[model samples]
Target: MEKVKESEAIEIDIPLETSLKKKLQQTPRWETFEPFALSRVPYIIRENNKELYEPKVVSIGPYHRGKESLRAMEEHKPRCLIDFLGRNPEIQIEVYVEEVKKLEARARRCYCETINLNTNEFVEMLLLDGCFILDLFFKVRAREPHTLLDVGWGAKTIIADLLLLENQIPFFVVEKLHAIVTHYEGDRDSLLYLLQPSSVSPDLPAKGNIYHLLHLYYQWFVPGRTSKQRSRRYSGILISTEHSRSNPIVSWLNSRSSRSNKKPYKPMRAIPCATELREAGVIFKRKESPSDVFDITFENGVMEIPMLPIDSIRRIIYMNFAAFERSNSAMEHDLMSYVALMDSLINSNRDVIILQQCGIINNMLLNEEELAVFFNQLGDWSTLDSDKHYFAWLFAEVELYCDSRWHKYRAKLMRDYFNNPWSALSVIAAVILLIFAAVQAVYSMYPYVHH
Candidate 1:
């Protein structure tokens, strides 16, 4: 009986060992996973407005590929591929297919999630999507419109869908297809120029390491500062150790002590709204023909902010840009920081009115209340490090100006006594009457003293 039991145990152990070995071989190496620039919208941001992050007109990537509502656009994709091939009669469809097939592995790594499709399916998707995108650009360049695509709201929504974070393929795939079709090296800037809306200035330089379409759009709009520029523009005051340089250890110790003695970092809070700032003597002006929308400046009690156009399409793009910044660690939070600053500046309709009056906000679609709510919600969705944002210096300067008692008193005096022409005239009249009364009293007293 003992010998029979030992044989059965050995038999069971063999299958178990084999199964364990197979599982280990199948397991992915987590450390080998690179950071993915294209990812789904984070739950924290999407919880409030999931629809905003999702593509409404079309699905460009695997994440939202087969939904029933998005199937209508899928049908048009094949037509786009045919149109693209028509333009490049020299190249065959198989050539495009084989080219995208070669890039399947590289393209898969760009997405955050593991795409469940096999090689054939993945390559087909890339080929169709890539050709579709290039076709749109070609048509736009020629000033011709697709019979189905450029009609009604379809064109606008398609542009919005292309900017969605999850709807992006690796930019290299598009560049590869463009190069093959045109038989010339693809200029990324030229390709990106076709994607921009008529409202966005196409002349802006699109220079950067672009991961996808959304990234290219971000680079055009929010060009980040270089390392040296950031270091110089940093709002924090640096401690000089010139005197302690004689002893290395002493310098190190002194630096350490100074750091330890410094106050703990406090998260940056929102600045006062536009109305409140106006009440505090901070002038608001629209920065005329600003080089960049984010180029806001505060000096001599005047705050010059670039005019921001508020509309449904722009709002969608800004939200996606903020979402991209939130998801990707490599991206600077320039857009998010801008949104936060706008949110802080516009707390209510009154705040919106103040900015609107100064030409800082070009209200196109949303009402004052809706715009206020939009910015407030946007600010809530974004996260910022107080000391590291692009606007940290601007925030500090504005707060410093607002904090001064003289500015507040001056503003209060102006507001309370001289807010309007009538009020100024009343103040002047009251002063004149008081002076006359003083003169009359003095004359009366003078006559009595003489007596």
Candidate 2:
């Protein structure tokens, strides 16, 4: 990482190539580029560190069944991918590789991984440069396209939505993919039918699926509409240390001492999930299945799980979990060493608010405040001004972003009110009446003067 000055904010260059940056720059800007906030978050940059893991194409065959060769490939795929992503400076890449491996592994177990990608880094990338991607999809759609509509906020659904929004393709995500073709294929009377079976010649490649169509509709038709309609379900996981599940932001809430003369961990009694913390409120929920498990959904959207202790959260976020697990729970890889470097960052930070994109929302069963503070005091460096600036920029950026969105919605409402026919018609009628009365008086006066 380039040394950044602590006193002044710096515009960190995108880890992406200059060409990619230029391409994205041409897209429309919704608001002023938040330079200060953007500067604080480390941009994506590839690393040459041999200590970092490299991603490999794991044989997804076990996911496909009857795949022995795939099992061997899978054995090495995750470790390689983690190492590759760890070396990169971009946090998104690190998060992505970790998730992909996890999903693939879960697939091997004959059960689907329940994680949703809508709230993940990939979705964040789409928000950043959706238009550019949409344009590319339009070109592809003109030739041939197959749309994929996802009913829920699943990973594949998100990926499908990303493709559609970036391109002007026709696609839909009904409750079920098969039902759309079987039930609504040819019925024009069906509002859904006009979208389905194309009256266009069978000769022409069928205009793509609902997924692509929806993306184009959102991008071109419903401008400013959400590309991915957020699902109501929470889509993140809570992480904590292994030994003690105490989160740094909740130091005051989860003290060993009792809150209401209630003995600690009273049987059959649930703890208060929401409470006032040092400078903010901490919210949490108890896990029904696991007595020790508690879900903390942060106000910023980062969810903290009490199942793991705070130290674990500190290690997992910075260091790849696979590396740590492989080392017999020892911090052997450079990623863990980097986690050590982040200890100062983790410690100095009094309040940590992880934005929803950080995968804190993966735990679905909680209200908003469980995740206010993540792990605290992993490292010792409160001295470096850069870290302070980094967090300051982050919080400020999020606040400004939210405020701008509110202002935009407010303006839209005002415009709609003024544009209503009844309001416009009343003003026009009043003006017309005044003009007519003035004309009549002028004509009457002219006639009298002539007589």
Candidate 3:
């Protein structure tokens, strides 16, 4: 190529290899990539709920991995790497680096960002982050709590930190590291079980590819039972996102509503609080061995619902789960829908009090008002059309159960007539006296007619 200099024309030769490499790597700025592993919470959602979106204590991936505040935890990464390598002394340090180097391209493609990191930097990050996670899991599984992990806000903070969307490494990298550590089949299966102590091991998402720990956690709770659409009644509204697939930013709502051939939806309504329904003679019972936390049923006069725990940890988990689901255009916002349903039922402290009495809400936070507010505010994190929500049918059923004329009348009877012994006795005496008076009148009328 020839270029004109300030004084004269200059001729320079470009290398074919370098030129080809530059051309091959060049991508259109407008072209967006589909998320293969992880993504940042969309600004639309994160802006409103910043605390819910950001990690507080520990950072995992390259995004938040190297902050001044997070440096305290960063020191543990090398120590973990050393410990992990010590376990498998036969495998050299260079081997792990090479293995991760092979995965560096695929991993770079996983994140939504265009990583500025070269191959060496990215591989180093993966190795360090992956080792920290592996060591943490190994220590937890072995019941050998590391001194740092057991100190103030240690384990609890790490659990929350690991579940952060931005703080995730590729599951494949973790699996590869795990395999390198444990060579035998029986031993390897145990580690997998240890990784998800809270969930059924058999169901962990293929070699299952997950976006991150939060995604994996969301999948962990999916019911093993094959029961689909448990409620016969669906209310509030039936809908799905009506968007053309060609658009990259497709709405997360279901597209079933667009199919003209599909059957029309039945009417459904939101349910009342536990106390209001109880007044209507509806009994609330805790579900036994239910597959899903949101699994609820209204049959005859009984409303059986699984208990939901309300606390800081649960709220954090749920918020991340909803964010993760919302980030992926293909997945449904099941967590958001469930939280919305609960939030709708709780208007104030009274509603929370009622649910607590019925064993409907664990109320672990021990503050009814706070729990209700937490659930209510969760809707702001992400929005899902109520009609297309997963629990629409359950809401309709509860509304139907509460609206029963017979139940309302029975509730009134219980409240007014059989409220207490004194009320019952007063009614009984009034009826007896009225009967006697009627008999006396009848006798008098009979004598007059006979005369």
Cα-based RMSD of the predictions, in order? 6.5, 28.2, 7.7
Full ranking by lDDT: 1, 3, 2
Worst 10 residues of 1 by lDDT: 239-248
lDDT of 2 by residue, 75-145 (tens): 43344334323334354454443434343322222212222333343332222222223222332334332
Give the Cα lDDT of each candidate: 0.77, 0.29, 0.70
Ranking by TM-score: 1, 3, 2
Say which candidate scores most in lDDT: 1
Clashing pairs in 3: 205-208, 234-268, 235-268, 236-268, 237-387
What are the per-residue Cα lDDT tens digits for candidate 1 across 1-451?
9999999998887877788999888655655444564789877767778777888878998989999989988998999999999988988988988889888878877776778999999998999988888898788768887875658887778888899988888888998898888776756656666666555565566675678888878876785654114221222443222221233223333454478795433435678888899999989999975447976777788889999887887788877887777788766687777887898888888999999999999987659998987776666656677655766656656755775799999999999999999999999999999999999999989978999
Cα lDDT for residue 1, candidate 3: 25
Q: TM-score for every candidate vs. truth?
A: 0.83, 0.17, 0.78
User: For model 3, how does the per-residue alpha-carbon lDDT over 1-451 read when each residue is reduced to its tens digit?
Assistant: 2345622432235567877888777852333443464888777867877777677777888888668878887787888889889888998999889878888877777787777887888899999988888888888888885966888778877888888777888777776777777764334455557577553446443244465666666777644223343324233333222211222111211232245353433434356766677788877777864346756666677878787766777677777776677777676667776777777778788878877887878887758878877877666657665555666545545655675698899888888998899999998999999999999999989978999
The alpha-carbon lDDT assigned to residue 412 of candidate 1 equals 98
Best by TM-score: 1
TM-score of 2: 0.17
Better of 1 and 3 by lDDT: 1
